[model samples]
Target chain A: MKPEQKPDQQTLSSTFALRINGADLVILVLTIMLLFWVYNRLWFKQSSGKADYLVVQIDTQAPVQYPLNQKRLLELEGRKGKSIIEISQGKARFIHSACRNQFCVFHGWLSTPGDTTACLPNRISIAVKSHSVKDTEHFDALAGER
Target chain B: MQLHFTTRHDDHRIALLAALAISIHIIESAFPSPLPGIKPGLANVITLFCFIRYGWQTALQVSLLRVLISSLLLGSFLSPTFLLSLSGALLSLASLYIVQWPFRQHLKYQPTAIGYALIASISHICGQFLVAWYFFIPHPGLFKLLPVFITFAVLLGLLSGIITQLLINTDTAKI
Candidate 1:
């Protein structure tokens, strides 16, 4: 490779040639701050408290939401056939399904907020999300209005 | 007559740079990172510097040697972690080549060392993440980790780039 210019002689005078300038530093700082803010918001921000519910969706139908405090067995219609899901102790899973792989069954439990398990062949997806206290209070207010 | 394109001197230069990169790789691995997938990847500074000084081929040689030798030392050879490292190195090299292509041919806006570092680092993380997601985890939740990975990449990328720039500008960087 031909030497374009000797670093010792040419570079000293042109120190800023490849160096990060003030503008670049400012931009970098801003970008990092923005990213940290976003990451904190997405991953660290607690939604009132721990997740208190499980949402089960099958195919294109509306999702069925359940309070985690209650324990029950739910049967849902999947694309291929029916699936049996179990909810117990604020966690849920696919106990039985017609799908061949039974991947969802092996996926174990969904207990944490943002945890999800899905069996595509069966078209059933389950997610754990926080049900805020305000929504519960709103529901209670609606009942009182009646 | 066979034309000797790369001389004996070039081979020595390549070996020297590769050794420097390998040392840095092993040393960086010793430090524990707060996050599992987050690392400063200081060895990439050598790759970027070599690319600017010599060319892409030399840069590739140095990076691949570093990954291979370091993994062997770390006892992760042929393991899933080794595969991830290999993929990351290969993708970073490929991206470096693509990024420098225009600058090599056209007198377009000359990309700074930071540009090369940023592009290569991001591609490296992406390559590793894709392999991890597809082979190791295979979960949609893996996508959630992308933002953190990218943020770390950006931070480390800029840092390594500035260090490379300082080394180059100070005449301390040796090819």
Candidate 2:
């Protein structure tokens, strides 16, 4: 082929290639989107119900435990620039903190698994662990100890 | 005669264009984003190519077809999400066509790519806002987020344009 013809040939080929690539890209995107939508619609189920256990671990080597009561489970207070963990509602959370974010306070009550309230400034996390009602034996084992 | 016959074959060219465009769309969507409803619009590179190579009509057709196919595949068809995609695609096409027109004479390929990309990004955001206002989110207060959305759009659009420009430049050089 002549040099002049070569440039035109290349251009034609590139154009064809780019066009094919575009079409394939569309098909792939559509397929993925469809799968995601179907999965989200049919399979992704949000959990419901309060957590059975609320675990609050302070910065210490050992985890502090509080009894579960209807009210005043957990509370944290800021004293002299130190975070004080106070379990008031038989659980623990920040009752008062000097931290700027106050994220823990806003976290409110997380009474179920997959629920978490955190105070990032204070490096505090309040989370709930759930036990199913069907697990009555396990529930009794834990509750009996209390 | 042989060269003319090979180049004029419509099936090969059209199929290739459609496939490429769709593939870009898929890739863009597949890449995860931190922010919900934000996309790089990777497929738009093909639309830009179409705009340059074919015409506005072909570009529009490719864009709309990509949106429809992607939405249906993603299972967002006939949903609020589909509407958002459709509106965004239309708006982007309009912007691409508009910008491509006035500057076609003076601007080089890269600059034209950049200009059209920015316009498309802005138009996409506006389309999203309109959809939000009409269908799901009726609150006028949602407009407050426009600046943040636009900023993200600009960044994404620029990146996309740069990549497309690189590809086109490479192709030109090879030719």
Candidate 3:
């Protein structure tokens, strides 16, 4: 065998290795496993992420921002009367509302993104929110409500 | 006075391949990405071809030249985007060099384009993120994005690798 034939032998794989080799298979498997781990890690962080803040939106007024981790009480004047809210343990809740049925207060604690409670009659609402720019993704392919 | 530059056969090959890579780069840039810094990097197909057919030197020339010319055309020269591009190209080339170094003269296991692509793309994004976090955004929060970026790198890397393998395996690939 001439030395010139060696180059051709090398190019044989380049020219005719139509079937993927074992190395290619291994690399593909490893890459897919990596993607799986990364997806699990990132999606878990995303799904389990807690709210960092609370926003109180009064009727036709600028929403007031409050930290979730900070325990505090807020009494804001609404359309009809005062609505009181409380923040504690990284959760926010409507403590008292000047509504007929007290529905907002009974709605319980809000602790994640897209969680909210509103006193409809008083036109006041408090929402648990997180300041993550990565919330752009939807829950499912069908664009289910988050 | 007739002054001209002498060139090798490989030089013209580099020019042609670089032009091809640059065109692909420009067309790819027109795409809208779901997130910044994520791209198919289709131009790498040309670079990988040059690497497998010619050599690492040719691949390096084509990749670097593509980044430089494409950035200039895209009006991002000397900017952060250029920095990321240059860094990613350099780091991926270095990784390819190391990977090919072992199989230089061998009769044993041959690492295919898939392995090289996986290594190259992952290290490429790692280098880019290093530059981004260190020079541009020095925040611990940025590290949270590492897994996400790497995930995309793996996916895109596999895609480009399959394309490269097909190109290499084709009978007319010698051209």
iRMS, all models: 12.4, 16.6, 10.1
Ranking by TM-score: 3, 1, 2
Question: How does model 1 fare in lDDT?
Answer: 0.79
Clashes of each: 0, 40, 0
Candidate scoring better on TM-score of 2 and 3: 3
Model 3 scores a C-alpha lDDT of: 0.82
When 1 and 3 are scored with lDDT, the better candidate is 3
Candidate 2 per-residue C-alpha lDDT over A7-125 given as tens digits, one digit per residue, 9 for 90 to 100: 77776566544222332344335434644554454346443544455666554434444444444523453232445444434344556666877666666555434455655565555
Residue B135 in model 2: lDDT: 59
Model 1 agreement with the true structure over B1-175: per-residue lDDT tens digits:
8876656877888888888888998888889999887899899999998887788998888888888898899899988878889999899889878866856865345466776777778889989998876666654456678888888898798888878887677655344
Better of 1 and 3 by DockQ: 3
TM-score of 1: 0.60
Q: How many angstroms is residue B117 displaced in model 3 relative to the true structure, after the best TM-score fit?
A: 2.1
Per-residue accuracy of model 3 over A80-115 as CA lDDT, tens digit each: 899989999889998898989999988898885767
